[model samples]
Target: MPSPADKLRALLAQDKLHVMPCCFDALSARLIEQAGFGLTFMSGFAASASRIGQPDLGLMSYGEVLDQTRNIADAVRIPLLADGDTGYGNAMNVRRTVAGFAKAGAAAVMIEDQVAPKRCGHTPGKAVVAREEAFDRIRAANDAKAAGADILILARTDARHEHGLGEAIGRAAKFSELGADILFVEAPRTVQEMETICRELPGPKMANIVEGGETPDLPHKELEDLGFAIAAYPLTLMASAMKAMVHTLERLKSGQDRTADLMDFGELRERIGFNDYYEVSSRYETSRRD
Candidate 1:
């Protein structure tokens, strides 16, 4: 497999906007790569939801996120970008957080300008740190790449909620000045606001199209026309999966679910790659017995 840097370089070279399906764990990451996605993101909301069995309320720890990053990195050949929430602390913490994710074999780490225990970007009652202090975090992240790790740094601004579109754009510009490789401005409410950000910032921008969020849905061609470098459709896969699982459970309770109604076991086994997975998993066990 090519190195993470090798894959990331290809992602950066694309003339069109690259799209990554956000994944929460190794199984999802593997499936995404097999499904032909060039990149995958370790989504903070999904990670917290899956890992802690709760909402994304800053409950997940730094080490836990890194562990998820490493697991996904090990399981897939494509580039993985993990969310580094608030860089795990202040500007100094941002330095260590960058190195930690790089050492974990991630291609990119996204840190927001928010205080610890921060809420989800789309959630209300959000707050941001002082602009000057937050920019320092970006500098530390740019400076803290592990040796030969080619890790990417994504600067995310949550200023769009408390502040306005103009403030978000201003912060994005400053983050770009502080050497952020990509700028993610959270929650643009309208297409005009989106277009303004694209035109205003000297940015390598990332667009988020989450269903039922603050961002209004636009066509792929429209998003591409707005100068986005990368776009992510997070939550769609998980939401669909969750709905199917719940419906299956309901059917089972009603005694309507049966082998005939279920998908073929063989087909599922093939899709999940059970044979290939066991082949890799068996090596250590067989060696130990030997």
Candidate 2:
């Protein structure tokens, strides 16, 4: 069987845009796989919100994120790209972060240029580290990969928010040259800026499509035309799921019928694999009796 990294590499080799729906936990990851999506990213913002009911302002610790990654990755056969927020410290820490995520079964681990306590890409007050420090983080991550981490390095730049697009492109170019497997320039405000990023950078490029964020939410073909290999929907699943839950809760509170808003219990059990578990367990029961 192909490893997750191998699966991701094969996907990148294709000349088309892969739509990636980001997931927060194992169940969500499994849903993405069952829905026939080729890839999924473990969104840090969603994970922070789900795991601790907190914002994505670097509140979740490294150990917490790693445990989440392990569960999500193990729950799906599709490739999982994990968010390694600010690498949790310096360049050496970046190395450890990369290695840990790899050991946790991540196909790829993203290390970004944001300073410690990094905010969400679409949110305000986020600043990147100095150029050298940013470059060093990717360099250290690459070193870990070179030293047998068994994971791809996704080098991301948030400099576009503070510095100009030129600076962001420059940092991403340097990251690519430093052996990053994927390049992500976060929050390009316009389609032209998005085009410029894909034009300027090499290797497999990713476009982050946060709903109502700075980047234009172009259609998948349009993003592919702009030279992006992957189009990531960071909050679509989380946002949609939350909206449904909230609506159902309102109906329940008002003593209104929520049957239309809820999934059938039988289907839910199958989706959660209870049906499969019972079937497999029955085989063991009969054999033991004999």
Candidate 3:
């Protein structure tokens, strides 16, 4: 069977856009795979929100995200594209970050151009590092991947807000030149801007569809027509899960039974491989007894 990285590369070679849904945990990764998605994305925003109960303001450490990546990768057969915000530090740190994620089994690792302790792309007052620093970060990531990491490098630029579209495009182009497997120009506000980004960017482009974000929420077909190789809905599952949990909790507090609204216990157990664990246990028990 092809490795997850190979699968992602194959998907990129196709004409259609590959839609990657974001997953914050192992369970969500499994759900994404069961729903027939070819690939899944690990959003820093979602991970921070779920794991630390905080915003994606760079509170989570490299080790924290790496641990989550290992769990998610273990739960699904599909390729996982993880967010490696600012490569967790400088050029040397970027090298270590790439190696860590690769060792943790990420198919691709996305490193953005924002400075350390970066905020979400949609958040106000965001800033990017100098061009030289950004280039060094991507170069470090590319170098690490080239040195047998076996993971694709996704180079993202948050310069559209602070540096204008031209600079953002230039940075993406440079990142591609430096051997990034994918290019992402974050938070393009309009369809025209998205078109320009897709048209001008050199290689496989990624479209980040954040719910209620600065970018326009164009359909997959439109994104495909605009030359995007991948379209990532980074916040859909997280937002839905949050709302559903809140509603269920409120219902329970109001003396209502919301169990009917959830998956039955048996089905939930099956989905989580309880029967498989029991089968393994039975085999071990018989062997040990003999």
Best by TM-score: 2
The TM-score values for the models, in the order shown, are 0.92, 0.98, 0.96
**Cα misplacement distance, residue 12 of candidate 1 (Å):** 1.8
Q: What digit string (tens of lDDT, one per residue) describes model 2 on residues 194-282?
A: 98998888899999999888899998889989999999998999999999999999999999999998889999999999888787777
User: Any runs in candidate 3 off by more than 4 Å, and if so which?
Assistant: 286-290
Superposition error at 79 for model 1 (Å): 0.5
Q: How should the candidates be ordered by TM-score, best one leading?
A: 2, 3, 1
lDDT (10s digit) by residue, model 1, range 138-244: 98888785334478888999888888888888988988887788889988999999898889987578888889998977877888899888888777777877887
Where's the lowest-lDDT run of ten residues in candidate 1? Answer: 142-151
Best model per lDDT: 2
lDDT of 3 by residue, 1-290 (tens): 88778888898889889998999999999999988999999999999999999999989988899999999999998999999999988899999999888888899999999977899999997899999999999999989988888889999999999889999999999999999999999999999999999888888999999888889999889999999999999899999999999999999899998977798899889888887778777768675564
Model 1 off-target regions past 4 Å? Answer: 146-149, 258-263, 277-290
Question: All predictions: root-mean-square deviation over Cα?
Answer: 2.6, 1.6, 1.7
Which residue pairs show backbone clashes in model 1?
Answer: none
lDDT agreement of model 1 with the native: 0.84
What overall lDDT, based on C-alpha atoms, would model 3 receive against the true structure?
Answer: 0.91
